[model samples]
Target: MNQSTNPSEASLHAIDYWQVVKNRYGVILLTFLLVFMTALVITYVMPKKYESTAVVQVRQKGTGIQVIPGMADASRYQESSSAMFFPTEFAVIKAQKTLDAAIENLDLVNRWNTDLETVRRTLKGIVDAQDIRGTSLIEIKVRYNDPKDAQKIAKEVAEAYRERRKKLQGDYSNQALDELRKAVIAQEDAVEDKRKLLSQIIRTEGIIYWGDPSVSGGPRGFTKADDAESAAKAYVDLEQEKIQLESQIETLLRYDGPQLMNYASGLSLPDNIIPVLLPQYQEQKRQYEAMKSQGRGERHPMMLSQASNLQSMEKDLVEAVANLRETLKAKLSLAQEQLARLKTRMDVKEDDAVKQGIANQNFVDAKNDFETAQRLLEQLKVKEISETMQTKITEDPIILHEEPMISNVPVSPNVTLNLALGAVVGMIFGIGVAFFLEYLDTSVKSLEDVERYLQVPVLAVIPKDVGVLYKQSGMSPDAEAYRILRTNIEFNRKNPEDNAITVVSGGAGEGKSTTLVNLAYICAQGGYTTLMIDADLRRPRLHTFFDINNSVGLTNYLTTELMLEDVILQTPVDNLYFMPSGILPADAAGILNSRRMSELIQDVKQRFDLVLVDSPPILGVSDASVLASEVDLTMIVVQHRKLPRNMLMRVKQAVENVGGHVIGVVLNNVDVRSDSQYQYYTSYYTYYAPAESQPMPSPVSSQPSQSPQPRAASKKTTSADDSKQDLY
Candidate 1:
């Protein structure tokens, strides 16, 4: 026996999800239709609307006027210009004053028939403004129930904005011009005073007086010639000092060489010695030459003494000359000093000329400034006259183009979207319901469920409303299923010697007795000697179904002193017999478990080809289990959708616990037509239905093929000699 690895997968085989869809297809179609119709109705009932838009450009403008001191400078003017345009524009766009004016001009409150509060709200709704990104543009749009009304409102908003802008510009420009005029006048007066002071300084300083010199030239107060003479004398003195320093340096260089020559000649020094001693002799010679120029000699008595002095001096000079150098450093120093003095004197004259030139330029600048101020004042006066003459649109306001418009096709009543969504939602709900029903269903509906839950092979499926025992009686097509079950049982049992079968179920109404009777009928019709025993003593039903006498049945045989032949009765069907529960036994379990009962079952097994015992529901009493213990194979009959799974399992367990081998399960009363998956087998009955006019199988054999054996020939036959014995 191969077992499934996953019991859940095995269980799923019983519940076909697609079959659920097929069975409940009407529900799904109705759901989709309802949702689609609802969407269409909602879409048809919605309202429509219209929209209109207007466009406006925001431009920046600057007035040639100043509001603060030095505001005319390009940097300050640029900043002020930006400030003027932005603030005024924002005020025109957002100010309640401007909005109210626009409302009044357009007669919006009257048109809307609104109060002050409503008028404000209406204006706000109709108008909107925002600076276009990275540009100076604005868009105004409005929505209304009527397209003409939307266009009218949009145009009115634009006109109101233009009027307000003109007024704001005029007021701001006039204010700026007035302030600028006063500042320019004040600046002009200050510039004139600065020029006068500069002219006075030029005259008093007695500088070169390059322009208009006669203003101070009449004075002997200061003369250019006198100053020039002083500067010349100072220059000459510095030159003379420079010349004397140069002459002393030149005289030292010229005489020093000749004295060194005299010293070298007088000593008769070697050429190498002369060169080495020459420098030292030159120093002494330089001093001697100075003294000789003042009338001293090398060989006078004074010269003789001087010669000795010279020798000593030469020795000292040699030491001094080793450290001395004729560098001419002092001459360079004196010449640099003289040159510095000359440059300083020249710089002084240049300074005076530069100062006079700076003063002249200052005077000219002041004159020009005064003239420019006069010209600006004239221009402002002209502008003021022009502005005063012109009319200003004093109530302009900014307008925006974009507005919130309700769509004619409402965004909410979207038919296609809603229907699609409804379909998905409904499918989810339907599948949930299907699975939920599957979870609650406890009956054995399919072979897979019976096998998985009961752990038994499905012996047969009895089609629902089978008319086998009624219409054609034994010749009905429904009898075929039972015949198949009989064949399966014979094939499944390993030993032909152990052929006593007991049929049982979980509950009373599961058709166990009916199954036994019909199975016996089919076996007998197939030429096998078959007997059905009504072992359900609690409620005996087999005799009533077969229209046989049940007063002298199994209970009578067990309790009375009677022969087995007296209790058993031959049925109307051929080769078939019924032994009903004679009378309800007080202790059916005890009676069924008696040694006599075992003997009876053994006798029937040998005498008959097949003996099917119909026992009571196993769960309701101990009678079924007691009979199960004595039978060769115990088969359970489960009515589809009648017994719960746990109860069915309990019935199987009861039989097994009593040492009975459960051969298989029979699924009874299955609705084959409605459940399509089962229809393949049951459909044959409908397609090739047997005619109601067919004859029933004969109760007795048509012809005897073998000799009828006496009781002595059977291995376990009961004696039938006492024919008058009381069975009940």
Candidate 2:
């Protein structure tokens, strides 16, 4: 029956984050409210800002075609660098000159009543330009205190940038014309020199070209370089024709006209015999055979003449095809000879051709320069003429793609967004604080907390304000917790007869005495004949509960040769008795640890169905350990969230160290009203009515003049004389 519970064997409880949050919810709520209120106040004081935006298309110049009414149309839609243009455009829109132009055009300096530098700085500060990514459009936005001003500034800035671009392009055009005019004069001088060289070459080298017969000698784009090129082309054509003729003749010479014409234009060649012979010979021979069938003599003239016609016809067809093929061969050989002579002549003129190519190249360069100059001269003259009448205007590369749009609503002090952000931040910070406080707190708060730390089952959860259970007229909800403690003690004790249980705590005012008396009363009501000994000799309260004089009880009985019946008295409750600490003995531990005290505990265990000894906090005195060693079971009574877990373990260790059996624990003074989670401890509240009446003969010493002194007591038997005489 002496079962030992080892602390090492118990599993440590994991600290639940949510449990900590629930326990310290009030602190979290307060922190959250403070943060949220601060954010709200800041939002309330923020100023409103109006914003307007204008969109402009920053196109690569000349990508968009232009329509001019008359004259030759210029090449438009030319491809250029577009991918790299957007970032440059963004910079240009915020340039100092561009912003200055916008300010002057809008008369913003006077309107703002500011100096030019101040106006420019302010405009730049308010302006923001962003190019739409992967696109050529730029958004020019302006923020201001006034909506009208925002809109006006946005529109004026876009127009100013457009005018600036047009002026740049016009200036570039004039500079380009001047450069071209210089090029034309230089080219004219070079062209005259080249013409004189060409005349000298004709006179000195007699380099005149006789036009080629096979070449189509019309004027190509480079007509000046075409003379020798035409002749070379004609000779190439003759050589190609000669090769074709030779291949055709070779195929025809192997063919007989009577055989399959393999090379006869669309026909193919066959065996080296006449194909024409087979049909003519077969026809004549069939005629000869038919005439022989008429019984004509062997020397018949018709048969002989038919045979001869076959032979003659075969010979003529063969000769005709062969003769035609021979004629083509002769013509091909003659053309080949002519091509050979033409190639020889061309090779002899290689020096002349190289010289001619140089002169022609020079002429072409001079001509191209002169032509380009003439075109530019005409365009510049036309531009000058147009400018004299009215300055020519060209389209701007960056134009206003969208009109400026001004919003009616202000964009600042967004209440919903601010509130949402505030809420999220507040919750996170509150949770952090909650966990921090939970970490700092070391009190045991729940059954799990106590069991995990102390490695003992919680016998009961004695709710807060336990006075209501005793004073109320009807059955009270709080009485159920004491009953549960009694039931758990009966069930958990390895030996049911181990009824001498001491209820001890780590510190004074942890409700150890109160819990012991209540549990005894409940047990007595359950027909257990419970006895409560206020071995808390340091501060006797059990007899005070019965209004029995506490000056004569356990101390007197243990310290003197007194009878146990003299100190023990029946309580007002039917089967309950009270034993008070008679007096404070100076040698309290010595008296309590004496063999007489053990005899007394053993005697009461036999007499009462249950004996609950209320001892001083074990940590505060050695007397509680002496009492615990004498009892059958040691039960620690702890105040909820009051005593640190380490102190509770110390209490348990103190009893077990003295060779006492610890049944479990009783978690007393739980605040069930504030935390509904503890309500489960007395879940049968609906079934329990308030106590109809206080137990009969309630204690006369109910009200205390002052709190009892420190739980350690040491005096003598003189203090407990009144209750000792009842034995006589």
Candidate 3:
């Protein structure tokens, strides 16, 4: 006995995709048919297109074979080969030159029914060209409505491309040859100028090979320079030797020491006096010094005499050294003079050598230039001859290798592919449209919708147009729905006698009145004294169901001192009673909201087992809200797929805000027969209860259906609710 509203779980269980598909299958089918048919019509009306192709062979024209380094002629000429050439032809096909020729050939402007510009544009769209891979060929394709016309245009395009290509190449060749001839003539002039410069250099500088002398075998210019350097080196050596000799002689003359003895001997003393003089003088000096150190007095006769002998020897030695020094000085003077003269000769020789070397280099460079210019001029002449011959040998770069054929079949209006695309597009669009419609629909369509959106249990499912169901002779399907609603109502309420329930709706024509009339009829048939009141003074309808007058009812009772019995009338159905919406006062709501109305309601509840009041739409009038406040429990009769969820919420809020208890919702007017989403409510219809004539099983023993319908009551006559529902 879980009684709480679990909206999330309810909503989750309610979104059945199969249920949606079943219910919206008709919409999907209709949309698909419409879209598919449209595609077919458009495809049928479109124009057909034919195609023709032509092939042209491109020749690789070049500067006829030459083996020159840095030669650009061959590469430059072959630059117009297929790689760039095919695209150029494609451009040519669309080019004004080529297109103009084709137009004149075919009279395209008149045939296409357009101006020159329009025809050109149209032709551009219809034509295409591509190179044959690994081959020197190109194919030109053109499309037209007529096969013959396609072939004709393609042929004309090939002819136009060929005519223009040859003429352009011829012109290019002439321009290239003219440039080459000018270059050759200019090169010849340069060679002549080079020869003149070489001749001028030979005449000005008497230059030949560098290391060679003049006409004679003996050195004249270069030899003189060589001899000068040699003489200069010899003189410098002699001067250094003389200075060493002079230094030896001077040092010997100054010495009275013993070393002068060795110097005089090694220094090659003269034959007459130097050898003995030096040796004897050394001995005497040594003896004198030795005696002096041994304490011999200076004035001693032997010492004086030895000192005198030493002085004489020293004087002779000094004279000999002086003579040698003077001779060395004379040799030094001669060496200095010779060194200066040789240095001067070396300087003059070097200056002459530097100038002659520069002149020789200039002459060599000019000679090499003359040779190079002569060779280049010869090469240019050969190149010019090869180019002249090339013009005569070159073939057409573009020629038709394969002609276009008249296509037997049109390329467009592919019926199969178009239909397939149409189906895919239609199905995608149809599904989107179906989901979009489902999103826009905000009405409650099923029991799950009511329970989930309103957060309330569905008390009953009153089938759509149930008047016919009740009119049928078999066990009534609709009667059972109302009986289930009754049982649920009795069990859902806390107290059995708390039955002052007002059935209301959020909007008009939601079958809220019908639901109440039928529910009341079923309740009375279930053996309860159910008194019905139409408190909706704005537009009363309960009296219309009872086929009774509403001139004197609840209004009369409330306004005057009338009793409950005065207004309440016995209904034709068993245990059912009726009260009409009597004369409406200017303030019908004022009358309904009075203490008398409250007393009247309570009195009827005490008299009858159940008091069911029918009221106007809760959102439309305040009269229902007032009645709802006075009632014990309020039941909302919501028409399936008629009112929005928000409006139903408003109805529930209207009742509860007035301090009334809501028993539950009655989902009325459901289309169980058509909408598969609601079909589950009537899914048990095939299983019938045993016929009434047979003895029935005891109620305590027999298990009732989860959703049980009413058993047949012994053939009753036409009921009050049935007659009124038929009228509706």
Candidate 4:
């Protein structure tokens, strides 16, 4: 059964913790005072130390040229600086190099009369460095017994760091400048080598170099005399002339007579004769057609003469056309010959151009290389000059803002802070101890502890030092506890006739007898006939409360043939009776376990309304267990916070093992004032106090009276000493 804590249970737990603290307040207070006083004494006796501080602003390292660009550590840059930068700087300030420099500056070896290592160790111990939050400022602090030495050490350390930083920065700058100069010299040599290669190529190739017209002075490609283009143009013209001549010759040969004359007339060749002869042939033919139209016979002389003239003109035209065609053939032959000559000339020029092209390509390549080298040389020269100027510009990285001075007031042994811390720690430690002790103690703390462990209801809670209730005048507030016990016993019993309850404890002095006496008195006052039997033959204590004699009681009756009425005596309190243990018996458990003791219990139950029995601690002996078995009900008297929970459980086990019926437990001697959780159970004491004017009647008579005889006097008669009564 796992239980979760509700708000009510949580509140109960808090109250339980507070109750523990209240109960052990003395231990907590003692622990707290001891710790607090120790801190005070230590603070008072510690030696004083004076502090001197020097303030300086440590700027982040600035951007500088790198011999190898993009290779510098980013932590040196102001924008890229990280949290570790200042811490690293602080470490540098306390480094051995800086401290050695400070020691040498102060001549600490001779002044302190120590060796070099000792002085360095002393300086390291006393010096401290830290950065101001959200700033680049550093504070160098030194502490010593003498204020002047502290001041000197603080100032010298800061100065040493500044000087060392400047020297390092200068060295880095000079190294970078040297690298830049080497780069410039290398670039110059590269440019000169490129120029020499260009000159060599020009001398070998025999090409004309065109100087660059642009401001950058880059290479312009070389040129050569080229006759191949002019030769090719002349050769194409001659070839076209030959094709036209051949076309005219073919036209003259394919055509004849009038068609040939018409086609030859259209030709405009330089050497053709067709245009000169064509017009004469046309006139002759016209004359012939005129004769034929006049109807002249073939034998007529005029017609014959006209035909003869036309035929002669035709022959002259044919002969002239043949001569013109032969001239065109001759002209075509000349054109072909000229074309072949031009081809040979063109080929010769092409060969020369190809040779010049090779030389030009070599010259261009060398010129490009020289131009690239020259450009790089210019850039390097500019960079080198800039770096040379920058090396002379020095800026200090550390600025001393506040010089160190001797402090008059000591800074160590802060009394107020130490005392406050001690108080807080002591209180926490005390609370822890209180809770630890409470955990170890398993005694019954409240009614819950009783019922939860014993599985029995807590019938009542009896306060501490509650004397015999029968002797209290009027109404004592403490009597209410016993009355509540009386009522609980009556209700808890299943049968009203089963009213024989023995009040027993796990150990002696747990207030078992006192609780029995009180409860019996309360029951009598409530008008019930209650009987208290002292069955503890080992150590009888009930007779002491009433100052009654215990010479002849329960023991005498059980050991002899005396009747029960001889032991039972009525007290002065109304309706209350007692039976004391007459003599100390050696075997108390044997006597109490006998059939005679069982009969006495049954006889008393029938005679009285309620019978309360008192016995010794059940754990120590078997007498209480024997008496417990003889009774109808057993009531356990448990002292609060006295017995361990396991022991209480064993007490209940002792009774039940003997066939005794346990009614419930009575939590006796509770201090409700300190344990606030139980206050509510006993809070009505003051409010219910008896008024001075309303005092109740005294239950006991002032003077001794004659003892009344029992109702069953015939069956069990008492001895003749019944008239001698003692009321004191």
lDDT: which candidate is best?
4
User: What C-alpha lDDT do the candidate models reach, one value each?
Assistant: 0.66, 0.71, 0.74, 0.81
Each model's total of backbone clashes: 13, 26, 1, 0
- Give the TM-score of each candidate: 0.51, 0.59, 0.65, 0.75
Evaluate model 3: give its lDDT: 0.74
Task: Write the residue-wise lDDT of candidate 1 on 448-564 in tens digits.
Answer: 888898777888899876543632533577877886688778767777667799999998888887788888877766656667788988888888876766887798989888777
Model 2 Cα displacement at 104 (Å)?
Answer: 8.9
Task: Write down the lDDT that model 2 would get.
Answer: 0.71
Q: What is the C-alpha RMSD of each candidate to the true structure, in Å?
A: 13.5, 13.2, 9.9, 7.2
Question: Whose TM-score is higher: candidate 1's or candidate 3's?
Answer: 3
Error of 1 at 468 (Å): 2.6
- For 1-728, candidate 3 gives per-residue lDDT tens digits of 24455775576456655456556778878888888888898889989889999988865456335434455574666666435766766687778889889999999888888899888888888888887787767888888888998999999989988888788878887888899899889988988998888678757865333322334653233343455567667666766765776676578567754565556556653442567677787789889999898899999888999899988888888776566557656666776677677667767766766676676667667767777888888888887776777777757767677778999898878878888888888877877777787788798877777778778788888777876222245456567777778878877888755879998899888887788888887666555556789888888887777678999888998988886667777766555677888998888778889998898777777666678999988898899999999889999898877788888888889888999888999888877766765567666544443353655222221111122222111212334344223212
Q: Model 4, 715: alpha-carbon shift in Å?
A: 13
| Superior candidate under TM-score, 3 versus 4 | 4
Worst 10 residues of 1 by lDDT: 719-728
Which segments of candidate 4 are over 4 A away from where they belong? 1-51, 60-84, 107-127, 143-149, 213-221, 225-358, 409-417, 438-441, 446-449, 463-474, 535-572, 578-600, 671-728
Which sections of candidate 3 miss by over 4 Å?
Answer: 1-28, 55-92, 110-114, 129-139, 209-338, 364-386, 399-402, 445-457, 460-484, 500-502, 506-632, 649-662, 668-728
| Error of model 4, residue 727, in angstroms | 26
TM-score of 2: 0.59
Number of the candidate with higher TM-score, 2 or 4: 4
List candidate 2 segments past 4 Å from native: 1-21, 47-60, 63-88, 94-126, 130-139, 144-391, 394-410, 432-453, 461-468, 507-511, 537-570, 580-600, 620-623, 639-647, 668-728
Residue 308 miss distance in model 1 (angstroms): 41
Against the true structure, candidate 4 has what lDDT? 0.81
